[model samples]
Target: MTHDAHSALLHAALDAAERGWHVFPLRPGTKRPALHGEQRCPGTGPCASGHRKWEQRATTDPDRIRATWARAPFNVGIATGPSGLLVVDLDVPKDHSSSDTPDGATTFAALCERAGHAVPATYRTRTASGGEHLYFTAPPGVRLANTARTVAASVDTRAWGGYVVAAGSTTSTGPYEALCGPEAVAVPGWLLSILRPAPKVSEAPSVATMGQSRRYADVALAREAQTVAGAVHGGREAALFRAARALGRFVAWGDLSRHMVEQALQEAGEAAGLTVAECRSTLRSALNWSIAHNQRRRTA
Candidate 1:
C-alpha cells in the first residue's frame, strides 16, 4: 500500500469511529483479523476467553484506534452488530457463466420492488471488487442473522455477529470508497421481516415427536445449503470451510449423508458464483478437515 492509502485507512477508521461504528484492524491487503499467535484463534471453533476475539476487540474508542493504527496501516473493519448496523453486500463477477444470476444491486432492487419497499439511500460504499455495500440502522430488539443470497442469488447480508470492511480500507484491488456520507438510515420494516427466522410450528399432540424433529432438521439443512449458495464477499475458501463444517456436523450425527453434503456444496458454490475448480478443491479440503475434527471430538 502507498503512503496515501495508509493515511486514507487511518482517516477512514477515525471517521467510522465518529459515526459510532466499532472498528477493528484487519491485516494490510487482506480481510483477516490482524491478531497474531496466542492472541488469535486459528480454527473453526470458538476462541478461548482471553484470546483476541475479533468482534470483542472491535471498538469505537478513539484512544484504542490511535494505539492500534500507530503500529501499522491496518485495514478498517466495522463490527455490524456492535454498531447497530446491517450491510447488504452486492457483487458482480468479472466473467459471466451460463448459470450466473443477476448482479447484486439489480437483485436487491428487484427484491425491494417485490416487497413494495424503497431501497434506503443511506451510507453506501463501493467495494474493492466492482461491488457495493449498502448500510442501514439495525432495528431495536431484533437480531438480524447474516445470510448469503437469501433475497437474490447475488445479494448477501452482514447483520448481527458479522463485520464488514469499512469505506477507505485498502484491498488488493484498491481502497473501498464511500458513495455517500457516513450517515445510516433505519432498516426497512419489510427487510426486517424477511431477516427474521420463521418460528417452527408446534408438533400435533397426537403426532410422534421423533418424526417432527426429523422434519425440522431436514428443513434447517436445506436452509443452510441456501445460505452457502448466496454467500459472497467473505473469502471463498473460508466460506466453504464454514459451510462444510456445518454440514459435516449433521452427517456425523447421521441426520444427513456425506454424499448429500458434497452435492449440495457443488450446487451452492456454483450459485454463489465460485468457479468449479475452486469449489471442488475447497469442498475436498474442508470436508476432510471437518470429518477428522468430528472423529477426534467423538473419540475424546
Candidate 2:
C-alpha cells in the first residue's frame, strides 16, 4: 500500500481507538512494515514508522479518515482509553481444514456455544481466500487476554482447520478469519453453570486472636488478588494496573466492609485454588461473624 493509503488507514484506526475500539497491529511475518488492519506502515515500536503514517493520515484527510474509521473492519472508538493496542496475525491457509466445522455458520454456532453466548450474524466475515472470521462480543469487566483465551479454549478452531492468529504473532498465508463486529453477547447458560460462584473455606484462627486475624485476612486477600490479577492481565505491569483498578473500585464503594470482605474472600479463595462454591460458603460464614461483631459494637 502507498504512503497515502497507509496514512488513511492509520487515521481511521486512531479515530476508532478514540471511540473505544482496540486497534490491533498486523504485519507479514516478523519482517515488513506493520499494518493496522489494512493500513501498512514502516514504523517500529509504539511510535514506530507506522505511527507516523497514522499521524499523517489523520492530518491530511480528516473527513476521509473519519469515514475510514466508521468502515474499519475492527472498530475501536478512539485512540485513548483503558484498552491498549494489539498486533495480531491475519493469514490462514485455505486448504487448511479442521475437524470442527465444514463451513462458517457451523463454526460460528459452535464457537458461540463454547463461549457461552450468542454472536451476531454480522460478526462473521469471509476472508479474501474464502475463510471466515467469527467475531463475538467479549464479556464486560473481563480482561482481554482472558476473553481471548476463553474464546480460544471454547472452540476447536484447529480441528476445523482454523486457528487464532495471536496479535503480534506470525503466520503463513492462507485463508484468514478475523472476527470483528459491535454487539455485546450475554454469557450462555452452560458456561455460567460450569463457572459456579466461588465458595468459602475454613481457616485456622491465629493464636494472636482478633486484630491478628483481620490483618492476616487482609494480607492474604491482597496477595491472592495480585495473583488473580496477574493471571488475568498476563504481565506484572498489566496485573498491577488491574489491581489498582479493582482496589479503586473497592475503596470507592467503602473500604472493605464486612460484606466487601466476604466478597473479597470468595474471590481470594478462587485465586487460591478453591472452588467458587467452596469460597462462597466460607466467606459467607466469615461475613456473618463480622456482621455480628459490628452489630454488637453498635449496641454497645
The clash tally of candidate 2 reads 50
Clashing pairs in 1: none
Taking the tens digit of each residue's C-alpha lDDT, what string does model 2 give over 194-284?
Answer: 2222222234242445565456546645764656433431122222222333333223223345455446545654564545764454344
Model 1: lowest-lDDT 10 consecutive positions = 199-208
Q: Evaluated with TM-score, which candidate comes out highest?
A: 1
TM-score of 1: 0.64
**Cα-based TM-score, every candidate:** 0.64, 0.32
Candidate 2 has a TM-score of 0.32
* Model 1 lDDT tens row, 99-161: 456788887786565445567788899998879999999878878878775544677899878
Mark the regions of model 1 whose C-alpha exceeds 4 Å error after superposition.
1-3, 37-49, 97-100, 200-300
Q: How far in Å is the alpha carbon of 233 misplaced in model 1?
A: 32
Per-candidate Cα RMSD to the true structure, in Å, reads 10.7, 14.6
